[model samples]
Structures are given as C-alpha cells and as structure tokens.
Target: MPIHSKLPDVGTSIFAVMSGLARETGAINLSQGFPNFDCPKPLKDLVYKHMIAGDNQYAPMPGVPALRQSLAQKYRRLHGCDIDPDTEITITAGATQALFTAITALVDRGQEVIIFEPAYDSYVPSIRLCGATPIPYKMQPPEYKVDWERVESMITPKTKMIIINTPHNPSGQVLLEEDLLALQGIALRHDLIFMFDEVYEHLIFDGIPHFSALRYPELYRKSVVVYSFGKTYHNTGWKMGYTIAPEELTREIRKVHQFNVFSVNTPIQHALADYVNNEEWYSALPGFYQEKRDLFVDILRQTRFEPVDCKGTYFQLASYRTISEEDDLSFAKRITREYGVACIPVSAFYVDKSDFKVVRFCFAKTPDVLEAAGERLIKI
Candidate 1:
C-alpha cells in the first residue's frame, strides 16, 4: 500500500536532532529555545494547588472564564487594549496550535501567506498544510529589518495574510513602532489578515518597548495575536498559550479549536487564573535575560564566533565565518561532535536552507551552564 503524506519532505525538527546529538555525545545543549533552569516554584505550586483542589477536568471550550478574564485585565493594564474575554480569548495547547487553527480557518486552498525567512519552523508547514503557498522574503544578517517595499510588491489578489513575529526567534530581532505602523498601513490597504506571534513579548532588552499588534486598531481588527505562558515562565514543556482576535475572527478560530484538543489543561488554566497577572515577575524579565545575553556575547567575542546585536528573545546569532567556511549544518554537527557545544544552524529556518555562515545559540540557560559551555567554546 502506498501512503502519501501532506508533509513528506519534513523530517525530524532541528531542535530534536541537535538536542539528541548533544545527549549522545555529552555536549552542552544550546540548540533548542528552552531554558535549562526550572520554572518559578510559585507557578508550579499554584498548578499543584489547583490540581489538589480538583481542577483536573476539561476546561471550557473557549478556556476557563477566570483565566480569560485575567488575560483581558492584563491586556488593558499592559498594552492598553480592552478585550472582552468571552468573545476574544481562547487558550490553546500552545502558540503553535493557535497559529495552526488561525491559518486553517481563515486561509483558503489557493490563497498565499507571506512569511519572512529564516522563520520559525512551524510557519511554512502550517501554511502548506492549508494548501496555501508561503511567500518568503529573505532578511539579511546584522539587521534583519523588513523591507516593506519588497513585501508590498509581493502582494497579489491571492495574498490573504501576513505573519509577523516580534522578539523573533533565531534572529532575536524585533519590529519597532515604525515597523508596525508600516505593517498596519499595508494590511489596511490590502485588506489582509495578520497572525502576530508575540510569545517572547517580555524578553526584549535594552529598554526596547514591544509594540504589539494590539496597539494598532486597524490591524487588531483583522489579526490573531498569539502568546505563551511557557515562554514567560521558562517552562516550554507546559505548552500553554492563548490567542486573541475580534469576535467574528474568534468565532472561526473556535470552530477549529473546539475539536482540536477541545480545551487546554484545566488545572493549569485554573492555576494561571491566579498567577498570570503578577506584574513584577513579567516586568523584570528583560533585565534578567539581558544579563545572560551580555555574558554569552562577551564570551563569544573572545572566540572565533562574532556575536550579533541581540535585541530580543534568548537566542543569539553568531557569525562562524571567521573560523570556518563550512556550511552551517555541517559546522553545527562538527562543533557538537567535536567541541562539545550544541547550536542550531540558522539555515534550518529558511525555506532554501540558506547558509549565511551563521548559527543560533540559546542563552536561556543558567550562569553555571552558560559558563561551562563558554569555557569549552573559548578553547576552540
């Protein structure tokens, strides 16, 4: 029997591959975008408390009312966006599901989605699964800024949506207010929908303010904003996230969401209801991660890898060109097997798997783990 696959060419994720390699060879694993440190104990305790109080059942199809209410309050307090939780917020298993559901529900079979390359691995696959074409706009190194002219030029009648991520993955680049305004103008002119990935919203550094899609009224009306509790609390394993959209858009997303996992973990939803609004914890994240980013950058400067300016997220890109002319994947594997340091090849993020002689290193680990990885890396 012959079985065709929707994603036939897709192999195992690079994160899994490099992490596996690190495990097998006892290398320092910095390939995946996850913290080596444990999540805050209070968050864990809150989950336990909810579980003990009998919150183990399925959550509401849209999400727990209390949790949604907390989120509504949060948006109002932080981003000045007033949301009606009942019609606007739906918690998903993670940010990935929210993105998938939105793409599937809104996009037609022949439509196109514009995604910037060296993108998050999930975006292209999600777009392809919808029978939608993904248009790649290649952004270069040192400054992964969006070329709005090139982006607008790519738009056709078939172009239905544009996906944007701030505090971006791998590149660690962020879209500023001016950038968002440009995007807003484009979306309004073209009547395009937006899928805004802001999971690393709090992880921005050097006092850079995160200009969320929520801030743009015209864009927010046609956008689904994605966020992750796991990214905030250093607990990616938990896989908790939510989406925000207008009532009509939310209606379509919930049509897909109701059957897809039905709802997120009830106990976690209950736990988050009590804990999500801790202004102090989220407020202090930028400075906390900035220290780690600075330490990692300083260490890499002494070595062959030249560190790029990392504006946001815990990931840092390094130019390995000074030491080796080898392709990124081969170089990444060589370093993991030989030097005992694991990093993700930046090419894996591109549709062409474009090698720019750069690789991404996760700086989300604790000082001791980072120091240990640094000590080994400097020797090479």
Candidate 2:
C-alpha cells in the first residue's frame, strides 16, 4: 500500500530535528528562535487575573472586541495608519495560522506566489497546500539583501501575491524603505497582493527603524499584514496573532479563519489587549532585546566564527568558514555533538541548501547560556 500525503516533501521541521539533537547531546540549544526566559510578570498576572474574572470561553469568530480595538489603536499609534478594527482585523491562533488562512483565501490552483528566499519554512508548505506554486527569488548572503531586478523578473501574470518578512528570520536582516518601495512598484505595476509577515517588528536593534507595508496607503489597500504576540511577548507557546487588511480582504480571510480555528483563547486575547495598550511596556522592547543581541554578538567576536551584522530579530548568522570548510548542516551537527552547542544551518531555510555555509544562533537566551555557548564555540 502507498502512503497518501498532500505534502510529500515535508517531514519533521528543522526546529524539531535540532531540538531533539540538542536534548540527546545535552547541548546548549540555540538552534530554535525562542527565548529561554519567562514573559513579563505583568502580562502573566493579567492572564491569571482575567481567568479569575471568568473571561475563559470561546471568543467571537473575529476575536474579542477589546483585543481587536486595541490592535487598531496600536497600528495608529505605531505605524500612523488607521484601521477599522471591526472590519479590518481578524485574530487567528498565531501568525502561522493567519499565513495559511490568507494563502488559502487569496490563492487559486496553479497560481504563482512570489516568496523571498531563504524565507520562513512555513511559507512554502502553506503555498503548496493551497495548490499554488512558490516562485522563490534568492537573497544573497553576507548582506542578505534582495535584488530588485530578480524580484521584478519573477513577477508574472499568474503571480497572485508576494510575501515579505522584515527583521527576517535566520538571516537577521531588515527590509529597508527602498526595498518596500521596490515591492510597492511591482505591486502597482503587476497588480499583485502584498503580504508582510512582521512578527519580529519590535525586535529591531541598534536604532534601526522598521518599515511597514502599512506606511503606503496604496499598498495597504491590497496588503495583509500579519503579526504574532508570541514573538513580541516572549510567550511563543501562547500562539496568538492577527492580520490587518482592508475590509473586503479581511472579510474573505475571516471566512477561512472563522471555520479553521474559529477563535483564540478568550482570556489570552483580553490580556494581550491590555498589554498592547500599555505604551511603556512595548516601548522598551527594542532596548531590552538590543542588550541580549549585543551580548551574543560580543561573545561571538571572541570566536573564529564571524557573526553577521544583525539589525533585527533575536537570530544572528555566523559564517563557519574559518572554523571548518564543511557544509552548513554537517558543521551544525559537528558543533552540536563535539562542542556541546546547537545551531541551525542557514541552508535549512533555502530552497537549494547546497551553496550556503552559514548557521543561525538564537540570542534570546539568558546571558549565562550565551556565555556557555560562546565558551564552547571559541574553544573549537
């Protein structure tokens, strides 16, 4: 008998594989991009308080009204964009769910979805599951910047959407205003939907500004902006996120979202709403994360590995050429087993993994964990 699988090429994710290896080898696990610390006490207390106040139940199909409204206020305050929460926002289980829902809602069979590579792993699978084609345009390493000519060439009549992630994962590069403008040009010329995954929006470092697709009103009309609370709040296990789109686009996305997860945990939504509304808490995030990022980079400077300049995200990419000439995956495993440190190969995020020789380490860990990993890495 043959196995039935819609996603035949997909198997265990790199995060899971590296995590299992870390556990087996008793290595400092820096492969997956998750914080090794607890969320803010205020947010946690709010969650418990909401539970005590009997806010536990199914939220509305869209989301709790307070959360939706708060999200709207956040956009206005941060991005200088006005969004009608009642019509333009629909919360999902997480940004992962929101991405899938948007893809399913917007794409048709045989359509092409332009994706920047080495993209988040989930994007490809979601596009494939929607019966659409993933047209990947690679971003060169070191700089990890997009080539506008290549991107423009990839657009076609069948291209329905282009997915962009700023404060990019694994690469730790942030999309610039020029990059956004380039994408806006393509969208305007070709009439393609623009989707931005900005879960790491607030994690930018070194006084770098995050450019949002919402900054352009024309682009926003045809864009779906997805964000995750898990990334911002250090509560990845919570898995709560929402999308901001025009009313018509949101209506279609909600059709898929309404039946998929229906709604998120009611109390979690309410608590998150209160958290976002607090200006002081979210405002300090850049400074908070910058410290950890700088600490990890400083430690890497003492090692043979040359860490890339990371403008945003908790991840920092290190080139292992000075340490070994081995391919990235093999080098990652070698370090994990012999050095007692775990990191993800940059190739894991690429469509073709043969050429890349970098690995990603999560700097979201505590100073002690970073020091331990750094000690082992430098010794090697």
Candidate 3:
C-alpha cells in the first residue's frame, strides 16, 4: 500500500546527503555543523561518574530537577529574568524536538506560521505535519536582514506564530535588538506565539551580545525559547535540549512533550547540571568559536569563494558565483566528490530549495582540519 506522505517533498536532509557522500568519497566533511574534536574531558568524566553512581534510569518528564535549577540560575544571571525551573522549562531530546513540540502545541490546522527564508530545514516540516501553512518571507543574501515592514505586512487573522533563529544556521546572521523589538510589536498586535531558536546562543561572535526574547517581558510571556545543550556542550549525539516559556505556554508544550519524549537521558542530565554550574564553561564559547571562525574565514580568503560576514554560529556562507554558475545542489555534490571537501548548499535551507550560488561550511572542527579543508577549497 502506498502510504500518504505529509512531507512528500521532504526526503533525506542535505546535511546527511553531503556527509554520506563525503564519507563514501573519503572527503573532508565540513558539511555538518558539529565539532570534529571531543568535548571537555571533565564534562565526559562527570557523565561517567553519574552512570557509575546508578543514574541510568529515566529522568523526570519535565527534566531532572537539578538540571532545570542550574538552567534557571544561568538564565537569571545572564538575562536578568526569573524562570521557574519546574513550571517553565522542559528538557527534550534536542532543540529540534523542542521546536517541533512548541509548534505542535500552538499551531492548529490551516493556521499560518511566518518563517524567514533560508530558515532551518526542520521548521516547515513540523509546521506542515500539524496541518499548518508555512508562509515564508524570503530574506536576501549578503545580509539576510529582516525588514520589519515586510514582516508586518505578512500578518493576517490566521497567522498563529512566527518562528525565528538567531546566529541563524546556513547564514550566520545574528538578530539585532531592533529585530526583536519589531517582532515583539507584531506578536503583541496579533497575539501570536513567538518561537525563538537560540541553540547557537553561546556561539555568537565579534562582541555582539545575544538578544534573547526572554530579555523582553512581553515577548517572554508569549515566546517559547528553545536551546540545545548539545550545541553548548559539544555533544550533539547526546541530544539534550530544553524549552522555556511562561507557565501557561509551557503547560501546553508539556502536554505534547510528555508523549513525544517523556524524558531525556538520565546520566547526562545529572552530568550537565553539575558541569554547567561553572560559568567559565559556556562563557568562553564565544571566543572559542570566534577563533575557529576567524581561522576558517582567514584561510578561505585565499580561495575564489567570496566569504560573507559571519556574525555567529560555526557555519559560514561563501558565494561561488565567481567560480561557477551552476545551481547550489549540483555545486555542493560536485565539490564533495571532486574537490575532496564537503559543504551544504544554502538553498537546502529554503522551502523552495532556491539557489543562491552559495554554500555553507562548518568551521567547528580543529584548526588543522579547517586548514586542510581550506587548502582543498582554494583549489576550487
């Protein structure tokens, strides 16, 4: 029997495709956004300690209390906003799940979700599965700046939510305070749910302060903020993340979350709770990633690819327009097979898979790995 497909167009993700091809061809993979290096040794040891101490059982549905409390303290200290760990935060498998859970809870059939173009791949599929319409507002390259006027004009009575990511993936554009203010205005006027993806919160660069929606009282009340422990702690495989919202919004998300992923990993939750308490661990991330970004960008300058200004995230976008006029998908695959370096096409992030002659490279690897990748890229 042919099963009906909700996401007929959604096949294997581009990240997986490129990474797979890189593996098959023995190419250096800069396609996926994960570090090639191991996480902090002490952090690993703590997880081992917890496992040995018999914390292998399932965690509480919302999360381990200790972990939630640690997160609450961090948010209070960083954002100056008090969050009730028990009521507001729910740990999930990853930011992806947290995002899907939020959308599942808020959007109904025929409701519209306004997502920016070159948006993350997961957003539209999640929205579609809920029978909601994804209304994309395309942001041009080079800047990918959000025009508040255009965003405001897209609003309608059926608009149920607006999803945004800062230190945006594929493109490394960070959201300014003005962007948040504009979103706040639109959300207030429409009484819409605001879903903020802040997984790359700590990965921002160049002295730019991360403007979290939790910073605004009104936005906080209406927003569901998703964050990744994997992104922060450099253990994407652990798949630990959480969502923060007002008590009421959280209640709805939790209703869906309980069944989706009743609980997160046990030992890791205990381990992360202990590790994150040290301020230096995450506080140093910006500078750490900035060094990697600088190394990668500096090396890429030797190539024909024109690098875009990367504000945050480990990913950097480079236009190959000068080198080839081919569409991004073909260009990405060809480079992986022929040039011995792999990257993601920026078009894969868009719903329509629009081409921009741009490709995204992940620079979260070691300097030597980036150097090797850079040398291969220079040949193209």
Candidate 4:
C-alpha cells in the first residue's frame, strides 16, 4: 500500500539543496539563514555550567519559570508590555514548533489561514498537516508591502487566522506601525486570530523600530507571537524559542505543545534566563548586523546584480536580471557551480514558484566570509 502524504507536493527545502550543493562544490554558502559565527562564549559557558550542575531532566510543559520571568521582563523593558510569566508564556523547541503548535491548536479543519508569499517554506505545509487551507497573498518584489484592503477582501466566513512575518525572510521587509494598525482593524472586524513571526525582531537594522503585536493590546489578546533564541544568539541548532499569547490562548497552545515537544532544551533555557538579564548582546545586535549588511551590499553593488533596499534582517535580495535572463533556480545553481557563491532563489519561497530573477544571499556570516563571497561574486 502506498503511504498517504500530508503534503504531496512538498520536497526537500531549497535552502538545504543549495547549501548541500555549495558544500559539494566547495563554494561559499550564503544560501542558508545562519551565521558563520558561534554564539557568545558566556552563553555556551552558562549552558555548560547548568548541565554540569545536573539540571538535565525534562522541563515543565510551560517552561522553566526563570526563563519565562526573564522574558517577561524583556517585554516590559523593550516593548513596555507587561506579560504574566506563569500563564502567558511557553518555551517551544523553536519558532517553527511554536508556529506549528499554534496552528494545530487553534485552527480547525477547513478553516482558512491567510499567509503572505513569498513566505517561509514551513507555513503552508504546517497549515496543510493540520487540515487547514493556506490562502497565500502574493506580494511583489522591491516594496513587498501588504495592502490591508486587499487582505480584508480575501476574508470569508471560513477565515480563522492571518499569519505574517516581519523583517521577512528572503525579503528583509519590516512591518511598521501603520501596518499593525491596519491588521488590528481587520482582525477585530473579522475576528481572525493573529500569528506574528518576529524571530528577527532584534536583527532589524537602520533604526527602524519593530512594531510587535505584543506592543498592541487589541492585537496581543488574539495573537500568538513566536520568537527564536537561535536567531537572537546565533545558535540556530539549539532549536530554542517561545510563544507569548493571552493566558487562555496559551492554555490551548500548551495542550498541543505538551504532547508534541513537551518541553524545550532544559539547560539552554536556564542559560538564556541568566543571559537575557544582561541584554548586552541583544542591545548591540542592530549595529553588529548593519556592519555586515553594509560590507556585503557595498561589495555586490560593484557587480551587475542590483541589491534591493534591505531595511532589516541579514538576508538581501539582488536581482540577477542584468547578468542572466535565466530563471532564478538555474541562475542560483550556475552561480554556485561556476561563480563559487551559493544563494537561494526567491522563487522557491512562493507556492507557484513566481520568478522575479531575484536571489537571496545571507549576510549573517562574518567579515572574512562576506569578503570572500563578495570577491568571488564580483567576477561574475
């Protein structure tokens, strides 16, 4: 008997494919969204310290109280939102888990979820696995701004949720206060649940403030906001993140969270609790990433590829139109095999594989790696 597939069309992630090709070809890999640097030594030490102290058993289904409390203080300091640690927060395996749990917990079969494309690869599949329809609103390149009126137009009785990403992956666009106001209005009118993917909150650049759904009272009540410690601390492999929702919403999310992941990494959560109190790393994140972005963009600007206006996030989109008329996947593969620098074709983010001749390069790498990739890229 043939095994039934939840996602019949889903295959390996494009990020994985490009990164693997880069490894095989001995090319500089900028296709995947991860830093070439290790996280702060102090954080690693903290994890070690806690583990050696023998706090290695299973964590509470909600999370360690200390980490949740630290996170609560963080919201107060950064966004001026007071969140109750005990009832409103739950540590997840990662932002993706937090996202999946929220979708599975709240959304019912046949319920519609509105997602923006080019979106993160996981969104549609997660919605599909839980038997919900993912309605993708295609956003064009350059600006990639959302039209609130258009979003409202897509709403039907079956519409249960609207998910959005800021400092968006593959686009580097951050949502502004106006965008939140529009979303707040629509979600209220339609009674739609909100899922805010703000894992790159601290990674935003050039003095643009991240307007988190947590900052808005009306939005927060009906929202499930996901964050990543990996994104913040340059340790994606840790797979540590959390969700902040209202007490009632969080309660429902934990129902699914308990059985799926149960709890996140224990020692790391302990380390993060102490680490977040300092705030030095997160405080200086914007400038740290800005320098890398400037170096990478400056280098690529000398070539035929045209860089888009990257306001936030470590990813940058450069249109390869001037160099090749080939589709983005072909261009990406050729560049990796021939030009020696790997990148993600933006078309892969879309369900329909909409091609704009644009490809995304990650700038989260160190100066040396960025310089090396830039040197090889300029030859093309």
Candidate 1 lDDT score relative to the true structure: 0.93
Check candidate 4 and list the clashing pairs. Answer: none
Model 3: clashing residue pairs?
A: none
- Per-residue CA lDDT of model 2 for 40-146, tens digit only, reads 99999999999999999889999999999998998898889999999999989989999999999999899999888888999999999988999988876788878
TM-score: model 2 vs. ground truth: 0.98
The alpha-carbon RMSD values of the candidates against the true structure, listed in the order shown, are 0.8, 1.1, 0.9, 0.8
Instruction: Report the alpha-carbon TM-score of model 3 versus the true structure.
Output: 0.98
Candidate 1 collision pairs: none
Clashes of each: 0, 0, 0, 0
Better of 2 and 4 by TM-score: 4
Model 3 ranges with Cα > 4 A deviation = none
- Residues forming the 10-long window of minimal summed lDDT in candidate 2: 348-357
TM-scores of all models? 0.99, 0.98, 0.98, 0.99
